[model samples]
Target: MSAPGGNWGFRTGVNDFWGEDHGRKTIGKTILVTGGTGFIGGAALRALADSEPGTNIRVLSRQPLPESLRTGEVLHVHGDLTDPSSLRGVCEGVSTVLHLASHVGRDPELCDVVNRHGTTALLADARRHGVSRVAYMSTTAVYGHGVHRGLTETGVNPLPVSPASRSRLFAEQAVRGFGGIVLRPHLVYGVGDVWFIPTLLRLLNRVPSWIQDGAARVSVVCVDMLGEVLSGLTRIPWRGGETYHVSHPRSTSFRSIVRTVCSTLRLDLPSRSLPVAEHREISRGMMPELTDHQHELLASDHWYDSSRIWRKVRQCPGPGFSSRFARAADWYRDLLPIG
Candidate 1:
């Protein structure tokens, strides 16, 4: 659950979750963002507002957001993806639908209702409204278990172990039928990531580094870079129903990432590596719901190949990707409130 006062319990003194300028052109186009109030969704909306001034941008949020939180140029529509009928008007006059809404958890039923059923409903509405294109935000977890080194968009499903991953994969298949684009981004980290980065920090405090195979290389991309890529999808003409793995050119080692966090906080890095067998035993003992697929992720590498996406979109042409980690550290240090 979210923290009290609408805060996501983010660490005090971090300033890493703001939007950047992408300089996109939105002439005569109306775009809809499903999860505009969310971290990545908010960033996408801000980028669009900055790049294309005066464009008709609409956000479908469950709760009404304060004016200061919005782009001022955006139209806020109160709606829920769980109810397909509520999404009808939300898709009206929207030529491009960026479906970023999703539910992440261990509950398979809840995951299906939101990720699978919600996506199905959204696509139906988009098709009904005659939307020209769509960009569906998905996770690399859909690829599932084992060492996913150099995995590409077209690679075989390694193994979907978690309820979240299975539901997401099902959602991907459902959306693909509509001829829309699906992007699986791995380890999306940025300032406003209350779940991803903060969760890692918490796990670091609780668990030993050996569980994740300290040297395992994992692919990651900054939320900002993902936003830019989302914007590119709108501008670039591509075949519908294609899946792209969005990530930075290089991968980060599990140990190095943890060490970075420890160094940033002036804390000592964990030296003990939990043996694979012991790690599994401990995980099952603690999180009995831990699926076989999720276990594979912790013990093995889950990297991806982004050559196809890079070849088409061209390199981001700036330091947007590399600067994200440092920016995250800065955000955690500056914007987060101190006790």
Candidate 2:
């Protein structure tokens, strides 16, 4: 689905949706966004370009991206997160840094290098340059497995299930010491999402419906909302070493998500539910390295309390929450038949 209001046009009135003046004048500082070519990072870059023009925006990446992804006079810096020396000049003259670059997924060593080592390196450099503030993009997966009915920011019951999650938790601690704001977004989804949606669709195509009990609840946030939160981070005064959970206020059922995907793609919905235990056993055998915590995440419920975030930055007051979900589903539909 395309962005509403047609043609992905740039928005000028910052106050039109959220009733907040996030105009260029309010943004009095330069910003640097790592992983700006990625989905969520790209969204944040676009929002900043529209709302905070004239603010020096730099994107840190190892390689060049398409011209279309480059929004509004963005300066691209060629650097790898694994190399600390390369990040020296990247953070120079930048007042704020949004750390979104990390190695996610199955590779343990790579995750350690990018998520743990890379974060530490960046934080050190930011401190050296005396950057005013920083926002580190973390995942709710750090909480790890089981029902999180009303998970809050203070909660730190991280299950060391996957290498990625473990490394992120470690990185969070390091970032906290550097006076960095850590944002833990649950299940971020949107257009240009090559990770979450494609993986879910593949699982849907391969597995039976009952494997996850069809009742698990998961918290989620649209990329647009996440972008707003990231941008707001630079303005708000963050409590040193504090973490904030970023998610849509409501928790949606796993079954509902599957149904939504099927409905959007005009595909047949799965009718049978497989026994949870049996599915777990099969999955473990197939993916032996997959941590038990990660496996448990499939059938687990992780609902976050986003009240603090809402109080800090007003959500875009447009349609109801369902409208956001529909937008995500529409985006998913447009990128179909992927290999």
Candidate 3:
């Protein structure tokens, strides 16, 4: 399925979709959400708005926000991460800041500029404006490739394979000193997700092979659930530089995920197998649009241990592994053009 425009509000009635109230506790502070227009940040903002009606939110975005999300409590500010001067008043009166904007590209220099230097500039502004707390949405890709089982927060982060991941690691280093929590979520998917699942579906349309026949075990999280985790963070007693891995404790096989996706979409799975090198070369020739890093992700495992964060959030896995994705499958499918 192709990615749709960013219009994911409560229209789909998935706000309380997980069968939980999602914590009605109020933060009562003005919060600034960078990348609020994106998937994770947008979901987190909606969850926060539902849970805390009185709380005010400031959004920094380069695009026009959907009319459905621009309520009185939600304020929009124009800014770009590449332009530090444009971020002049974004942190004014904001007690908490959620750093969600980062470059997800192939260029090393641009990635560092936006992900590393951009974060550095934002945190500096937050500190200067007396922002009390901050939260960073880092990725599990920082841990690198291979069969990672039950990986911890302080677990050795191997050299990143993608330029985006490497830049995020540098950003995490800057955020470590910013006096708040860092959440590293793996394979976050749901409505409005343009990365994890949608990208795979698009690639699978062209490539007809899987690495190791897609038997690798991996960890994943629902975007709404990740948003819930972000919303609940303000209420928790977290120390500065404390990092947490975010995902279900259980891991699902990569083959099962692909099968479920195909079944849900009424599409057929690839019937042939090829060596990793041949498949990579063929896929690159077939779809020159996708980055090499994105292609590598489908072949690796990124399972992590989320027991500690799960206990603190006081939330259980919403439904069985397959059922959760099945429930949202239609939403993703709708984003694709009907063939």
Predicted structure with the largest TM-score when compared to the true one: 3
Candidate number achieving the greatest lDDT relative to the actual structure? 3
* Local accuracy by lDDT, each model: 0.68, 0.70, 0.74
Tens digit of lDDT per residue, candidate 2, span 52-115? 6676677888777669766566777777777776766556566678888777777899889888
The sequence of per-residue lDDT tens digits that candidate 3 reaches over residues 1-339 is 001011112121112211244444333466678888888888889888887787777787776677977899987877778777767656766656788877787899889878887787788777766664788988988876565767888777557888898989888877887776788988888888777787777777778667678876778888888888887775454567878898878888878888888888888898887776787888888878766656666776668898888888787767645888876887878867421
Off by over 4 Å in 1: 1-27, 208-213, 282-295, 317-323, 330-339
Clashes of each: 17, 4, 0
Q: Provide TM-scores for the models.
A: 0.83, 0.84, 0.85
Give the higher-lDDT candidate: 1 or 3: 3
Which residue pairs show collisions in model 2?
Answer: 1-330, 1-331, 210-273, 210-274
